[model samples]
Target: MNQLSIFLAAGGGKGGEMQLLMMGAIILVFWLFMIRPQAKKAKQQKQFINDMKKGDRVVTIAGIHGTINKINDDGTLELQTSPGSYLKIERSAISLEWSQQINKAAATTVTPTK
Candidate 1:
């Protein structure tokens, strides 16, 4: 009876260890799949925001399209939608590089050769 009890306790301890290992692995996978990519994206966004300069066209998160007229020392951007028409927006408001190449590609209409 004593030997049997000891064997059962050892088996239970191994099962507990395996459960702990599985939990750790799950946490690691969650970080890898979810947390890590988010961190990397945030870093990239920060870099893009910091690299903003005058004359660079950008699209805001709210879908406003404009040229960066000035960058404030406090991280706010002064954007001009048209001559003398400007909006002050936060650095995070900018969404993507509104490059001329992208605009040109979008403007070209393709017709299928039938």
Candidate 2:
């Protein structure tokens, strides 16, 4: 009957709408929980690279430690390990900053005295 066909069509349309809504919600949740955090981390990395300056001590990704002697405009760093030792490294090779404040806080928390 014509009414039966109309009823089936309407039901199918409603199911399709629900499926679309569910897919959209899943994509939104994936972006929020996964993609957004990665984007934020990349932005932070860009800011850190831009803020680099001479005299800042840095640790390279290859586990080399040195003080920044000069910063080149083309994303290169001249590092001084000692009086006469120097090396050129790409800006991305530097990892997070090393700070004495973190060491002091960690030392205080692990005191042997009761």
Model number with the top TM-score: 1
Error of 1 at 11 (Å): 1.5
Q: What stretches of model 2 exceed 4 Å from their correct place?
A: 1-8, 97-114
Candidate 2 lDDT over residue span 1-114, tens digit each: 999998998799889999999999999999999999999978877787788788876777787878889999888999998889999999998775442343355678886976
Model 1's alpha-carbon lDDT is 0.84
Q: Model 2 misses residue 8 by how many Å? A: 4.6
TM-score of 2: 0.72
Model 1 segments more than 4 A misplaced: 1-8, 97-114
**What TM-score does each of the candidates earn?**
0.77, 0.72
